[model samples]
Target: MRILQQMNAFCVMTLIAFSISASVQAESPAPVQAAKKALAVGQTAKDFQLLSVGGELSGEVKLSDVNADGKVVVVVLRGFPGKQCPACSAQVGDFVKNASKFAAKNAKVLLVYPGPKSQLDQRADEFLQGTKLPAPLTFLLDPGYTFTNAYGLRWDAPRETAYPTTLVLDESGKIQFVKISETHRGRSSAAEVLEAL
Candidate 1:
C-alpha cells in the first residue's frame, strides 16, 4: 500500500512538472533576430535582380546590366509600411522630374519598393498609378524585403519597411556615394545625386 502511494505521488509530481514546463514554454518570448550590417561607400555593391514594378520593361532587372551601361543610382524607398509614405512619393517625383538630367549624366536610377510578400505587387502598382517613370528611371518591387535585407537597409520596426537610402555605383559597381536615412525625411535630393555622378 505504501509503495502504491509513493508511485501515485511520483505520477502526480511528473504531471505537475510537465504542466509547468509547458506553461513556461507558452510564456517564453520569441528569440530576437540578429542585426545586419549596413552597406557603405567604397565597397562594391552586391548585384541583385528584382522584378520591375512600373516601367517600360516588364521583367527582372539585373544591377550588373544597368551598371554596364553607365553609373547606377539605387534609391531605396520606404515601401507601403501600413500606408503610403508621402516622403517617398515626393522623392520619387523628384527623381522622375530629373529623369532627363540623370540620362544626360549617363546614370540609371533604380527605385526599390519593399514590402510584405502579400499584395506587394498590387501595392507597388498602386504607388505608380499617376507617376510615369521615364527610360532613365526604373521602379522595382522587393517582395518580402529580399534585396533590402541583403543590402542591410531593412528598417525592421513597427510600421516600417526599409530605410530611405541612396547609393551611387560607378560603372565598375563600386559604391561612390551612399546615404542612409533612418527617419522619414533626410532624403538625398536629385541635385545631390546628380553631382555625385
Candidate 2:
C-alpha cells in the first residue's frame, strides 16, 4: 500500500510540473521575427500598400505607385511607443522644412507610422495635430507592424516600435540611400535625402 501511495504522489507531482511549465510557456511573449539583414542600398525595395493617415492617395498608399513618377523617401517613425516621440517630430520637421527641395527633385516622401492596431489611427492623428504634410509628403499607417515586419525594421523591444529607418528609392524601386537608427536619435536629414536624389 505504501508503494502504491508513492506512485500516486509521483504521478501528481509530474502533472503539477507539466502544468507549471505549460503555464509559463503560455505567458511568455511570442518570439519576434528578427530581420536577417537590414535593407541595404542598391537592393530592390519591397512594395507595400497601407492605410494613409493624410496624403493625396485617397486614404490608401502603395509604395510602387508613389515611386512610379519619381524617387521616394521612405521614413519609418516610432509610432506611439506610449507617447509622441520628439525626435520623430524633429526629423519630420526637417523633412517638412525642405519640402520644396524634395518637390524640385521630384521626390515624394512617405512617412511610415507603425504601432498596434488598436487606437493607431487616433494616435497618428494626434501625432500630426500641429504639423501639416505638404503635397510631396504622405503619412502611411502601419497597423500591427505589418509594414514594419515586411521591411525588416521592427524594433520589437520594450516601448519601441520601429528602428527609425529612412530609405530613398529610385523610380525603379531600387534603394539608393538607406539609414537605419538603432536608437531614437541619428535620423536621416532632409539635405542628405535630397542629395541622394
Candidate 1 structure quality by residue, lDDT tens digits, 59-128: 8999998899889999999999998999999999999888999989988899999999999988887888
Name the regions of candidate 2 deviating beyond 4 angstroms: 1-38
lDDT of 2: 0.86
In model 1, the number of clashes is 0
Name the lDDT value of residue 155 in candidate 1. 82
Query: Model-by-model lDDT, in order?
Result: 0.86, 0.86
lDDT of 2 by residue, 1-197 (tens): 99999999999999999999999866523322233244677789998999887854557788888888989999999999999999998998898888889989988999999999999989999999956688798889999999998887888889999889899998899988988776798889998888889
Error of 1 at 3 (Å): 69
TM-scores of all candidate predictions against the true structure: 0.80, 0.80
Ten contiguous residues with the weakest lDDT in model 1: 28-37
